[model samples]
Target: MLLKQMTAAALAAALSLFLSGSVTAAAEEHYDVYHYDCWSEAVPSQAGYTAERAVSGQDLGVGNFSEPTDIFRDSHDRFYIVDSGNDRIVVTDAELETVEKVFDTFTMPDGSETALNSPQGVYVAPETELLYIADYDNSRVLISDYDGNVQREITKPDSELFSQELTFLPQKVLADKAGNVYIVLGNITTGAAMFSSDGVFQGYYGANTVQTTPEVIVNHFRKLLSTDEMRSRQARTVPSGITNFDLDDEGFIYTCSQSTSQTQDTVKKLNAAGANLFSSLGVTWGDIRSYYDTNTNTNYQPMICDIEISDDKSINCLDLTTGRVFQYDKEGSLLFIFGSKSDQLGGFTEVTALESCGESIYVVDKRKNTVTVFAETDFGSLVHKATELYNAGYYEEALAPWYQVLQYDGNYVRAYEGIASGLLVKGDYEGSMRYAKLADSNSRYNKAFEGYRQEWLSAHFTQVAIVVILVAAVLTGLHFYRKKHIAKTETAERSEQP
Candidate 1:
């Protein structure tokens, strides 16, 4: 009886240990983290950002979020979540631990009471401390204060520039420092509707240009040759409209377009003139290669649904197609990619919006009715420190951090590039070239080679000069000796002939 009892105890202990180990392994493999190399190949990397926790409205004691479509973080570190299904906006503290306010009803300027009708988007202007809500079903944008007092109600423009046949359905809204409000409509493909602070429709803002492909070029020529009636019968093609946008502190607007076939202008960084500053970079916004699902036998392209620019100018793009977050630097170099479409804790079922605060990223899943918080790991922090220093023209100061990044992720190509740049700035051209080669940065490698050549010449300048001088003196002596010997031989021959 004693032996049987002892065996039972041993089996229980072993079973518990096995279960714990399995859980730890599963947690670590919840999601994959990688970055693209210069060749546009996905390179496995350490997790730069890991899912810390998923926060629901229930967790904050504000009831569960019902189909939250958008999330915005104001300058005051407050978060505003647009609960579309609930027809309200839930405001929370920076940590998302406590509920601050919930906006569902408001008082109109004329002392009339009103309520939000399926508000899809929300933004709080730092300058005016006012809330901008995109009232989807209501066909208007409501500007109100924290107390839910409606200051202005902007509806569809009655001007001829806007088509009267179209319905006024606003999806997203944002205001610039100049108080110019830009709104993304559901049907208008021209661009985001722009309005002045005084509630006057100015015009369209940043508009995407249609991609000129071979098929488009052919269709254009065919239409020109066809008669008016034939041209009218032909199908027309228009540019994909901007789906969402965000504004940075510098007043620059970043827009994202959700399209599977269009890759030209999936993401745009627009200036005040509404010109795309990122066009010249020729960089792909999301995954470089199409993702193939073995289970479904289908290939999926990145459909960027939302974009968030961090304080350090890192662009975090949320891809709805793959439910992955692609984070890039200011120069459009990919830093990290994480998340997936799964029922797992780290994975997102339907990612709708993303926002960055400090070193953490918050992504909202509409179907899941929760916001997953991703906190930067030590590897991510090191990479960010190096990137910040390198971008700020402090290459020498970034060297140590970049090296430390390599210790964590040896396959991190950005770390190699950063190290190469730092080495070049520190006058270690040879080392720079080596690292540049590893990073596949031909331009950096060429520059380093040139610097190395110049340095080598400068170091051996005396030896090179002395060798040139000695060679010249020896040649001159040989010339003189040959001329004298020829003359003496000619004289001896003449004397012998006489």
Candidate 2:
């Protein structure tokens, strides 16, 4: 009996250990959290954000979301989910815990009732408190109030600038601070359709420039040599249209386009004048490396489908092909990368849009009909605190937090860069240079090296000056000695000859 009891206890302990190990392994396998180092190599990293929970329509007391396409959080802290399949908009509270209202029908100004048909996008103007819905199948954008009263309807522009044969299938809509409306249309490569506040067509805005590739260069030469008929028979290459966009507090619009072949202009920060501000940075917006799929036996490149600018100015870009979220600082430096394509809790299927609220990120999955909420981890908070200070020019103040970040993540390249910046500002040039080298920041290292060189020269200036003076005096003495000796020898030779 004693032996039997001991065996049972051992069995129970083994089972417990096995179960715990399985749980830990499962959690780790959910996502591969990593960041690209200065060498463009993938380095393992601590998760900046984790999947806290997933909220569905049923969780919010509304029915299940049917193929939701977009999510927008207004200034009032309410979420407007565009349920495209249901042809309705579901409004929820900040936490997505309670349903506020469901907008299906709206009363027109002339007292006519109309309903949405396959709406794809929705945005709320904070200042005007108006709702902008991109009614896709209806081929129009509707501006309505919270009470479902239509204020205006913007349809396709009848102008030479816009192709008359193409349908105006609005996919996403946003309004600038000046009340100028921009709509992303289906199958239109020109750009987003822009309209004035009063509903007048203002032409397209923020068009992407075509990438110059070797093939394109060859094609250009071929077109030049070919006849007009032959050139017309060839297919015309055009820039990919904008997939989605978000406006920042400063009125800058961030747009993302889904393209696997084109790298340039995949993501753009456009100014009011329609110039890409991020063009000069030359930063890669999504995953730096391609991923191989065993099922398809093919490599998949990053397809950036959506982009969101957090309140703190962190740019969050969503990759459709891999279902990863790449978060970058305001200067386009990548901070963290997480998420994947799976059916697990943290995984996503057909991710369409994302919105950030405070420290949480809400990602909408169309195929799953659910929204996954990711909360910032402690490490993420530390990084953000350090980044905020660093970006604001408080390098010295950010040093401590950056150090703490290194304690958590020794491989964090950004933390090294931050520490180098702080040390540079504090006149620790040598120390700054060391950290800059670790961060792989050549620019920062150059600056630190220059500072160090100047400091060294300044400190040993007197010694160097004395040595230079001594060398000059010795050369002068040698010159006079040689001249005098040569003259004396010549005089002796002449006297001897006489």
Local accuracy of candidate 1 as per-residue lDDT tens digits, 201-258 = 9999888888988878999999889999998899887888999999988999999999
Scored by TM-score, the top model is: 2
TM-score of 1: 0.89
Show the lowest summed lDDT stretch of 10 residues, model 1: 23-32
- Residue-by-residue lDDT tens digits, candidate 2, 285-379: 88887888899999898899999999999999999998999999999999888889999987998999999999999999999999999888888
Work out candidate 1's RMSD over C-alphas.
5.6
Error of 2 at 136 (Å): 0.5
- Name the regions of candidate 1 deviating beyond 4 angstroms: 1-29, 294-297, 466-498
Q: Assess candidate 1 and give its lDDT.
A: 0.91
Q: What lDDT does the true structure give each of the candidates?
A: 0.91, 0.92
